[model samples]
Target: MAGTGRAGVWAVGSAAVAVGLIVALAVRERTAAPTDARPLVVYAAASLRPAFTRIATEYEAETGQRVELRFGASEEMLTRVRLPSAVDPGDLFAPADESYVTSADKLGLVAESRPVARMRAVLLLAPGRMPPTAWGDLASRDMRVSLANEAAAIGRLTRQRLIATGLWRELEPRVRGAATVTDSANAAKLGAVDAAIVWDAVARQYPDQRTAELPELTGIEAEVRVAVLRQSARPADAERFLRFVLDPEHGLRHFRDLGFRVVE
Candidate 1:
């Protein structure tokens, strides 16, 4: 009887030890499991590349969070976010024009949006040439100009303004089409054209690039608006980044330095 009692005690002790080991192993595994640490993805317009890149770098430094930037035309960014099967959806979208945000919101892709900056069209002139004082000056026979095609946000805005002012018919014949505002600027820079119409901020990117603003091109401005996608895997983190972007001392300063007018 004594031997049987001792064996029972040992069995119970061993069982308890085995259970404890199992529990400890479970706790260890739980603690050791990897976290979801994927970098936040952002789809932004190409024109916003410079300022947004700086903003993202500052944001990453301050928060220690990674950002993946994908830059393209505003419309292209919107299309990608809208079609996840075709392209991986991004956490946020920063288009050069606010209309893209509105379209995203209509498609139920955007959770929220905020205005960042404003840009307007300007005439980028080649070196050693006089700046055109007015829109009519572009109508001169000797003046060859490059313009962004309708696909780019800047191009669409420029075309809309010219059509509204009844200058499209007169200007279209003299204009050579470029795929983007940067390309239009480059056309002028390379002397492929006498002048190119591009965003005011883009013109500032080129040092010694003479630019002339035509007062007649009123309402040709585009607002850079950022949208947080509803499908973001980390909505809270995305919102945090959005707040940082709107902070006057943070992202706004970068835009201002790049010649973009702060929206606020």
Candidate 2:
């Protein structure tokens, strides 16, 4: 009877040991699963929507990795990355201007950065309106112009250019502030304004709007840059996506198709 009891006890202990081993293996596998298996979160400037959307789709198909994209004004995206109140911090950021990346780097929020593209500011005129011959034409009382507010990269660039040319004061009264270059372009498209200053690429999106290339505005260009966030939970995966974007055949092609000047 004693020997039978010992055997029973040993069998019960072995079963428990087997169950424990199985649970330990499961936990180890769950912890060791490749972080790349999870979706990479990217906060991108609204201006990058077209190109990024396409690139992300292709990347998912090719690598079997998923991507979650959040688009807004470049500054707004930066703010979201910095605060991240109710949301998870993004793994990557692609702002329309490099300045935002510089600011993020100053805050110790950036792990790496790369230049993606470049865009020049241009005047988008409403249909049937003759392109202005000079900057002063925008200041004319008959002209109603819309410009992006200072919160947007294009808006900041527009203000800087207009100030340098000594036309900001003259043009200020005639200008209606918009939240983004896209908004300013929309105002022109809807004929809410006679003209708007927007990125050349944005102007291309509207076939009805005519782009005016002025020698004075030639110097206004923004370098679109992407950065890996230091606080990213999946840094390695984020880096892989970054490299895919920087690849000429993959991401740059889409930007070029959208009329964005692809940077080498």
Candidate 3:
């Protein structure tokens, strides 16, 4: 019994020392001879999460680079860029709406900002639920609908457009009385609510939940954008990433798969 106990202690100590050495070596490698290429940093809108992730992976595999993606509301991304070091200025900034893209661009945070993908507004239905074919259907007295707050997004823009055509004024009572506001359109994509007004990219991104197309005549359309952050350490790499995204063969197909419209 004593011999067995001594062997176990010795083996454990040996294993611990081996692990510590391996860790130290890895740290040394990271510090001493890190790659000259800057790590690809990206701050993006939540709606772009699905598509951007795919692009990021592809870019890394092709170039042997590392990518770090930050997902947040459009407003939060803007605020973080201006305020301080909470978020490292990544190689790229991708926003969910044109308004946000323009806002951040004007702040002088990026070398250039452009619409990478266009997303229409969409109506989301709960799991195993049927989507409304028209905006008026959302006004059904029994239907409990929701919309994300317009402060961080253009949902308010959508609402106003609807009202201008009188589509929303009739629905205003319905929206006010029942439509709950969330911080993001992605939240409305969840199945908990009966119906939600969300970005088209979100609707198409999560097909398992269920979505039916609203008529194209519906008064809402929005564009999603990308910008190269000025503070990024890898401007050339960032430009390469952007060029890869504009590549017709891969980038177009990738965006199309995520339900985005590639504008010429």
Candidate 4:
């Protein structure tokens, strides 16, 4: 009877130890870093693709975090941010101009925003084409000019410049509209149009493209801005990525290399 009682006692002790071990393993598994973490999603302006791509590559190398990029016109990107659902929520938004960021902020879509770089509009001419001396030159009947559509940030800026210089009405009839600033640049590159009003950085992107300064548009700069979205499921990671992009040696360097001026 004594031997049977001792065996029963030992059995109970072994079972408790096994249960404790199983509980500890379960807890550790729950707390451990996921082996396949979801990539951070970034929604950026089309014009920023080159710089952002390089920056994202560097960021992934440094942090071992994957980055998924979605590029489009700034206005379109803003619209996406305003309508994020569970299936399509984004982590960050980097628009071509500050006005869009401000608009997003006003709508409670942006948690925080920081200025990243600056760009100015310029006239991009096709190979062997003479640079236009002024905006009026683009209004010539012989000139085929492309401008971004009204829904794009660059489009709004270009229209505002034309209106402020009293050239919108005259130029409107002659101008063809592209969906984005990059598209405007491509129009000139592909000879679909003789020239385009595009951001300076985009003009530099194509070696065959020549730039003509628009003096009337002087001092009119687009302030590139990045913002953390209120809809981000991982705000900490998003903020960290934002800081990485703003770092002088990391993302800002790429922007500078791409012909963007640092916003002071």
Which candidate number has the best lDDT?
A: 2
Model 2: residues with Cα > 4 Å off, grouped in runs: 1-37, 85-87, 139-141
Deviation (Å) of 47 in candidate 2: 2.6
Worst 10 residues of 3 by lDDT: 176-185
Candidate 3 overall lDDT versus native? 0.69
Kindly list the per-residue Cα lDDT of model 2 for residues 1-264, writing each as its tens digit: 366698888888999999999999999977755455557889998878989999999999999888988898888888888885444668999987888998999999999999988889898998878998887677663789889888777888778987998877888888889988889999999999998988887898998768898777778888889999988888999999999999999998888888889887
115-200: candidate 1 lDDT, tens digit per residue = 88878888889877789877777776368989988877778888888888888888888889998788999989989899998878
From the highest TM-score down, the ranking of the candidates is 2, 1, 4, 3
Clashes of each: 0, 0, 1, 0
lDDT of 2: 0.86
Clashing pairs in 4: none
C-alpha lDDT score of every prediction, in listed order? 0.85, 0.86, 0.69, 0.85
Local lDDT at 88 for model 3 = 53
Clashing pairs in 2: none
